[model samples]
Target: MNKQKQLSEVTELWKTNKKQYVKKSSFSAYTLLIENHVLPTFGKAFHVEETDVQDFVFRKLESGLSHKTIKDILIVLKMILKFGAKNKWFEYTPFDIQFPTEREKHSLEVLTKSDQKKIMNHIQEHFTFRNLGVYICLSAGMRIGEVCALTWEDVDTDRGVISVSRTIQRIYVIENGIRKTELILDTPKTKNSIREIPISKDLLRLLKPFKKIVNPSFFVLTNDARPTEPRTYRSYYKNLMKELHMPDLKFHGLRHSFATRCIESNCDYKTVSVLLGHSNISTTLNLYVHPNMEQKKKAIEQMFKALR
Candidate 1:
């Protein structure tokens, strides 16, 4: 009979094998989650029972982790467990974890039309390269990292489009009992995230003069070889909001505002999903396409008309 191996042993082996296939950012995420959450609890265990995982979920929830975050941790945990099973180091047992039903309905935060207009108008009136990132995010719904990663070369004024291909983020690295964080430039979040967004005529006019003067390789936000990271850019945005006397909102609120505006303008859900670089239209509909009472009434009326 073979002796069972600790999960930590299998995880180290899995890490070495998995590192080559995944992006650095993804591997870093898995490492962080494993080190912070999984190792302390399950590293020494030769077998992970379903009850143990369920308890871990409850404990994480009690510690104020969101369901999504807990799920991410569990995904990494499952991968390690599966790897252990494949290598004959542990018995395979599928976990069926459950969570208590969440009662509170979460709502997305977005800027009001009036506040959005104020910020846009202010940026247009006092144009700067850093400010251009804010404008592009509002107009094109680019994520902060995507806008931070943008280069002058990505914006084609003649073609009237902004090509999005990459994103920048800081990630944690752990090695030999050492921990450090570093910024990395990598491909977009998903394949769908590599997309082109049309530039508004106003934005094109604002960018035309600079297009001829700036180096094509320079980042759009910095207008230099160096790029401003999302954290630094977020601080700038917060200060701008303060100066404009706008209500406090997270940087991602700009994206929500753009998507909300598109839905309000009667844009088709699929087209809006594509424009926002969503993997599928269902994500767009689930997030942005909630029907109001008026729309529901109209839908019912249309059904009666069809009956007639």
Candidate 2:
């Protein structure tokens, strides 16, 4: 029998291969997961057993890791294992892991329409480039990274659209046993995320005059060549919320509020999905399509009418 190889050995090979194929941001994420979670647990193992993985799952849960995060860890682990097996250095074993059922339905936080309006009204009266970023997110449903990456060139007044091609984020990188961070401007999360969304007339009016005068290459948020990273922008947003005497909602709630408003306005589910640049309609339906009490009552009435 051939001698088995250590998992750490397989991981190094896999990461080298993975780095060539994936974005720098993606490679960074995989490396962080592997080093922080996978390597310590299974670096020396020649083969991973199903029971060992199950126990690892339970331990991660006890340590307060979410099921989704643990699942991501397993995905990276399996890739390393598969790579090792293909080289005939380790045995391949498929493990079917189960998670405890979650009974409580977690609701997404969204801003109330009045609160959303308050912020918008304030921005319109007291306009600043930084505050406009929040308006754009609320109006167009762009993610924080996407908003941070936006430049004047991406906004087209003639077409009344915002072209979302890239996102910016700071990622951890490890090189030659030295760890550091890098801020990268890369393509958006998925191909679907690289899309064009129409701007609302209100926002379009605000942007049109500035589009002609501002440097096309300058970032929209800072009106400068240098872009603000998401962390700094998030801090600005938090302070803005406090100044407005609003509830302390996470920045993502602005996106949720936009999608929720679309649903409330009776927009078609697929249109809402496209506007939000969701990879699938199901994602939009899942997050923002829960029927209200009035809709539920109407649904029941229609069903009874058919029966009668």
List all candidate RMSDs to the true structure.
2.8, 2.2
Specify the poorest-scoring 10-residue window by lDDT in model 1. 287-296
Reference-based lDDT, residue 273, model 1: 94
**TM-score, candidate number 2:** 0.94
Spell out the clash pairs found in candidate 1.
Answer: none
TM-score of 1: 0.94
**Candidate 2 residue-wise lDDT at 82:** 90
* Candidate 2 lDDT tens digits, 1-308: 65788999889989988888988998898999998999999999988999999999999999989888999999999998898898888887999998999776878788888999999999999999999999999999999999999999999999999999999999999989999999999998789898889999999989999998999999999999999999999999999999999998999999999999999999999998988889999999889888766679999999999999
Q: Tens-digit lDDT track for model 1 on 35-105?
A: 99999999999999999999999999999999999999999999999988988998769989998899997
Q: How displaced is residue 219 in candidate 2, in Å?
A: 0.4
TM-score of each: 0.94, 0.94
The reply for model 1, stretches above 4 Å from the true place, is: 292-308
Error of 2 at 265 (Å): 1.0
- Global CA lDDT of candidate 1, please? 0.92
